[model samples]
Target: MDGRAARETPVHLRLTHRGRVVFGTIGTLLTAGVLALLAALGATSASASAEQSEQSFSTVVAAPGDSLWGIAESLDPEGDPRDLVAELVTLNGMDGSGVQAGESIAVPTRYADAPGVIPAQ
Candidate 1:
């Protein structure tokens, strides 16, 4: 027989105290690293937040040919022009009745912001 064991390295089972200690330490380190990574991600998400934007609006008056429907279509297409009677009534110093020809009013501009908010002279 040669000086080598037959059933040696073929199915080598590391059953020694030192081997078990090394494997346990490796497993503990891996678990600790994964836990730390999860903790860091949680902390980052908790600290994250969103921002808010402030908005303002304005409009022009109606002319001889322009109707409330036309003004609403040009300014606030999402809203009904008839509904805008409230705003128009408030702005152009008009009654709940209606508007006249050659009369200008503030049309709500939802498509974008007022270029420069200012008062009429």
Candidate 2:
């Protein structure tokens, strides 16, 4: 080939041993970082569910003409109904304070035993 043709030809790129080692290490680190992040996310969700499952619930069937205020009061006569009502809403994933007759709802075991009173931990 002429010198001019040789000059125009593309040179193939090559990596030295050190360059290969560096690239390999960088790839491995990125992979490990992604796996670790995923693992942490999984563990967080698992722990949250575990915490929720640890708390036991009691089923209370709604009687005719029953209201959330009434139920909260019945659960704890001496304690504020608002707190219990809020808890019940959260427990049942209710949109509002409405309760239908004969509908079963979950009540925390602790609240059923003693209305408005949480025993010392």
Candidate 3:
């Protein structure tokens, strides 16, 4: 063997211990960052679905003298009752503002136990 061949190291075997440690640490950090980002994305999607499920509708029984306007006012006091009544009409597939007593109807509600609200019979 020539002395020149003995003096020169192969390119594939050029990394030192410190270089290997640095590369390993960098790779670990990159993996951890990617995992954290994926977890955050997953959490956001989960919360979005949870929120969508939370804003669901509720069933209510129409009482005597309970018009769509009155039901809408009781269910969503903070909102425009006319709009809510219109939505109720469309949701129940009603031809007009007429609602019979003891009839089941769907109403938009944010809480399961809403005050002054009658449940579906």
Q: In lDDT terms, which candidate is top? A: 2
Count of clashes, each model: 7, 1, 0
Q: Which structure is stronger by TM-score: 2 or 3? A: 2
Candidate order (lDDT): 2, 3, 1
Where is model 1 more than 4 Å wrong at Cα?
Answer: 1-59, 107-121
Per-residue lDDT over 1-121 for candidate 1, one digit per residue giving the tens place of the 0 to 100 score: 8657765677656669988999999999999999999999987766662211122335454567766566655555577867766665664556653666756565445433533223233
Q: Answer with 1 or 2, whichever has the higher TM-score.
A: 2
lDDT of 2 by residue, 29-120 (tens): 99999999999999999999889967666767788998989988888888999998999999888999999998877887776555433332
Measured with C-alpha atoms, the lDDT of residue 67 in candidate 2 is: 91
TM-score against truth, every candidate: 0.34, 0.56, 0.46
Sliding window of 10 residues with minimal summed lDDT for model 2: 112-121
The pairs that clash in candidate 3 are: none
Write down the lDDT that model 1 would get: 0.60
Best by TM-score: 2
By TM-score, rank the candidates, best first: 2, 3, 1
How high a TM-score does candidate 3 get?
A: 0.46
Weakest lDDT window of 10 consecutive positions for candidate 1? 49-58
